[model samples]
Target: MQLTDRQNNIIAIVKNNEPISSQNIAKELGLSRTAIRSDLSLLTMLELLDAKPKVGYYLKKGKKLTNIDDLLEKPVSEFMSSPVSVEENQSIYDTTIKLFMEDVGTVFVTDTEEELTGIISRKDLLKMSIGHGNLKKTPVSLAMTRMPNIISVKKNEKFIDVLEKIVDNEIDSLPVIDNKKIVGRVSKTILLQTIMNIAKKF
Candidate 1:
């Protein structure tokens, strides 16, 4: 079961103050007791918390905290967005325009056959621009990080694995490859949004 952020916060409060009252929990969260009434009820129904007459809620003994393992194990294909790509030979000026138009932090670079070849980041373009390079005359290839060094994820890869790659590499996004072709792209924003959406559902 996936616990919403509020639910997790409630759990922490109860853990630290086992005899905490609903009023106190709401106060810690800057919400009214009525506002969190449903959350408290749900947690109780889930057996994660217990209530006593004239007392407040408390963590149920031996009950495990909620986990998002199922959500994290979801495939990348379910959350990846359409990739914003540029041809290897496309001019830096054009690529920069496309990047802004799409509002993406990174863009995939492809060859004539549309095969993935490299990746260009906003930082890369910024560095080149600051150096007074002629953007219109420079090919995106000159500003891209070429393959053999690029970190990519497969379509069926788990979200947890993709997150690890992004964090370890300090990258903003990754291209999703299938059959050696770029099918989609995954980014920190997408993953975060996925979690936020799930929280909203509950």
Candidate 2:
């Protein structure tokens, strides 16, 4: 739902000048009607705008803007992303590589049974590296924040509840658990993006 800058501009133009033609909107933005054809179509599809046969485009009435409180009450399962995990016995060096390759702030640690056991963060790896110890020989379990100590969430948990935990714990991400197994991860970045997407509708 994140709109491009041009899309936002188009919405603004259409809002201020109701029943405005696509040709005029494009001219106002110094573009061609063909160039904004897709933008108009998308805005209409999102119900932010509406069109008529002979008329042009106008802001859609009667549709309520997104309510942030209601949005946060939705389940985390709807927004969680696939988790990036490493085995507990994985070497610190290899696990660090996995973190970089995954481009994630934290990595979940799993046992031989593939159940969640612990969690590791980029900060944890960096702290271990300062010792100048042999990372290849050191196991990731040595640096992980073990279960019962790790902050986590369930898939059905409310988004607002997860947001509260993240803010209270000062953590970057939480592993989504189901029957003790990691199913997904909800991160600060994802939460912020979701909120921004809703905010743009206003």
Candidate 3:
């Protein structure tokens, strides 16, 4: 089920054992009945557990993962990393070196005002250096995937929704923008790893 952390813990306590009273659960969790009442009610409503008069609670047959949200609607901010960046005026030679040094596949490009203007991938740099032959003479801007064409996400965007954008755009990563500037980034690597962990539990 798409449960919050506290709700999941409540389920675990009930699952690992059985026929536990709400009073016992609250005491075990160091919470008051008043604190966990809503979670208990919701779990009972979902039929994940059964309650009987004076008997408290017992585990119902699990229909788990059938209701579990794969992504749990987590915000992209939780997975964001600092984006490796380059100036719009920097040479492709410098940009290429920074790309390797930062160990990121893409470099977000910004102007003198620190406003995002473009983005460059290793493929973009490789194509320019190999095809044009003069890396030092060409600004990164000359080969960059320019702004207004960049598909970006916000800090609060859900991970699953952003995953769709990444696959649809065929991109390895996207810059996280806020207030018209880059804040952080999220990538396919982290997305895949996170979901793989969830799948394992399922």
Candidate 4:
């Protein structure tokens, strides 16, 4: 969408100091909160912004094939998700609800000591339910894909490398690992957002 000079200015401010709240933007721009919110909503709908709830909004990053190539040659942690994990044995039903509620497609399955055991996805649960036809009696472990061979990305890996893994493997995400433990998940959504962030450079 075409942006007005004022809108461009707002984007610039956010780019410089992102994760700033609507109220803060309103005060800084000397505009009404309603106006700021309107701008933010429009920008977000346009996919030019991303809000992390309590973390506020950030400029979406975008990248080209060349950029992706360069990214693959760089460190992965540059855009990796922060470590966030959930325990294993958390029923598939509950886990499904949690994934939807959290707006994440996958969650790492960990043991009591937080060691990675498996990876679970909404699709995995759906497949299990549709085929085995029973979830009430099935544990997440039964539906989870075991580890040791689970795909993963290191914090220092690059986006291109991760992209190759995802596209070539037809998987939605890769768990970020360190010392054989899952620290986070890298999904297509996060990759898209990182690309949007790069686009804002225009």
Candidate 5:
């Protein structure tokens, strides 16, 4: 889980002071002592910190670091990437050009309300191009891989779980779905980028 900005500031205080009370933290940050109680509770809950009744909060530096996989057992919400999408009723010709302009391997298709309905891949467009179809008259709804056929990830799914789905299915990316609506995307490229970022810490 990613730390909130306020939580980070609390950690910084505990780190620098070695053992700081919630009251002192509130005083330093100009917040009420009660305001920081939940922050301390959350830090403790995540195992980044520990506290005693009188001595106050301290970083859990003596504890062993989590296993790599455990460290990465976070939600896709932490590593979500902006998605590329097009409306389902759009002309296939315009959608094809937009696909190239967006420079994505696959573009999600949405209804007039911008709710995800399907997807159109470059391969799909290529096949259509070779068929000598009338682009201006063809609707993307006809060419798209429609609803119920779309493979998508969820906001709360473990990040690695999403990556596994991508590799096992041999797909380029999966849209991040939340309560049946598309919110973001996770591509193979984005997954690689995340791995590289984590590698830098060691």
Candidate 6:
């Protein structure tokens, strides 16, 4: 569920004084009772709030990243891309052409077992081949940032925290991992699209 600024503000207010009645909160915040009720229901479904018909709603306590089971259960899965990979032995020319044809900015480099070994981005290739060698001869592995060097996320990660990581790390995308296998990617485009879908009504 996407939260609007108003709903977020209500969350903050509820956090400060949880177990708050919908009527009391509506009066205090100067928002319509119907609007508060609707937002409250959505927030409850998102697990951000807990509500009891007569008892009202209370904010769920904890840091955003601390308890993510709820967030992971939502449209978060929809924002991920199937993990795409290329072999380490692949040539830069072939990789570059494929990347362009696929219109992707980066591709993960994996071993024969499909474990993530590294990541080779369009920028990585461009910078590595700028001055010296033949593009067709240069191997993608030589230009890839090794696995431990690239940032990655787990399948159950929260969308908000993942977005914060992307912005703070100044990176384009993060590979998603499951059982030591590269399962998917979470990119800026996906994040934006998810946000748009969630916020369209607001």
Q: Across residues 104-139, which tens digit of lDDT does each residue of candidate 6 receive?
A: 788889888888999988789789768588888888
Residue-level lDDT tens digits of model 2 in 141-178:
99999988999999999999999999999999999999
Deviating ranges (above 4 Å) for candidate 5: 1-67
For model 2, state the Cα shift of residue 73 in Å: 0.5
- The TM-score obtained by model 2 is 0.69
Tens-digit per-residue lDDT, 149-200, candidate 3: 9999999999877889999989998999999899998888878888777767
Candidate 1 residue pairs in clash (backbone atoms < 3 Å): none
lDDT of 3: 0.86
Structural similarity to truth (TM-score) of each candidate = 0.71, 0.69, 0.68, 0.61, 0.63, 0.63
Q: Compared with the true structure, what per-residue lDDT tens digits does model 5 show for residues 90-161?
A: 888898889789888788999877789998888888888788779888988888888898899888898779
Local distance difference test values of all predictions, in order: 0.91, 0.92, 0.86, 0.76, 0.84, 0.78
- lDDT score, candidate 5, position 103: 81
Per-residue C-alpha lDDT of model 1 across residues 1-202, encoded as one tens digit per residue = 6679999899999999888889899999999999999999999998989999778788888766435688799999999999999999899999999999999999999998889999999999998899888999999999899998999999889999999999999999999999878999999999889887766653
Global local distance difference test of model 1: 0.91
Off by over 4 Å in 4: 1-70, 131-134
TM-score result, candidate 5: 0.63
- Per-residue CA lDDT of candidate 4, range 1-202, in tens? 2567777777777888898887877788889888777778877877778789888778888711223445447666777775445677677777777777787777778889888888887789788767754565566887788887688998888888888898898888789888887766788887888777666656
Of 1 and 5, the candidate ranking higher by lDDT: 1
Q: Local error of candidate 1 at 163, Å?
A: 0.5
Residue 195's lDDT within candidate 6 is 62
Q: 19, model 1: CA deviation in Å?
A: 18
Show the lowest summed lDDT stretch of 10 residues, model 3: 63-72
Where in model 6 is the C-alpha error above 4 Å? Answer: 1-76
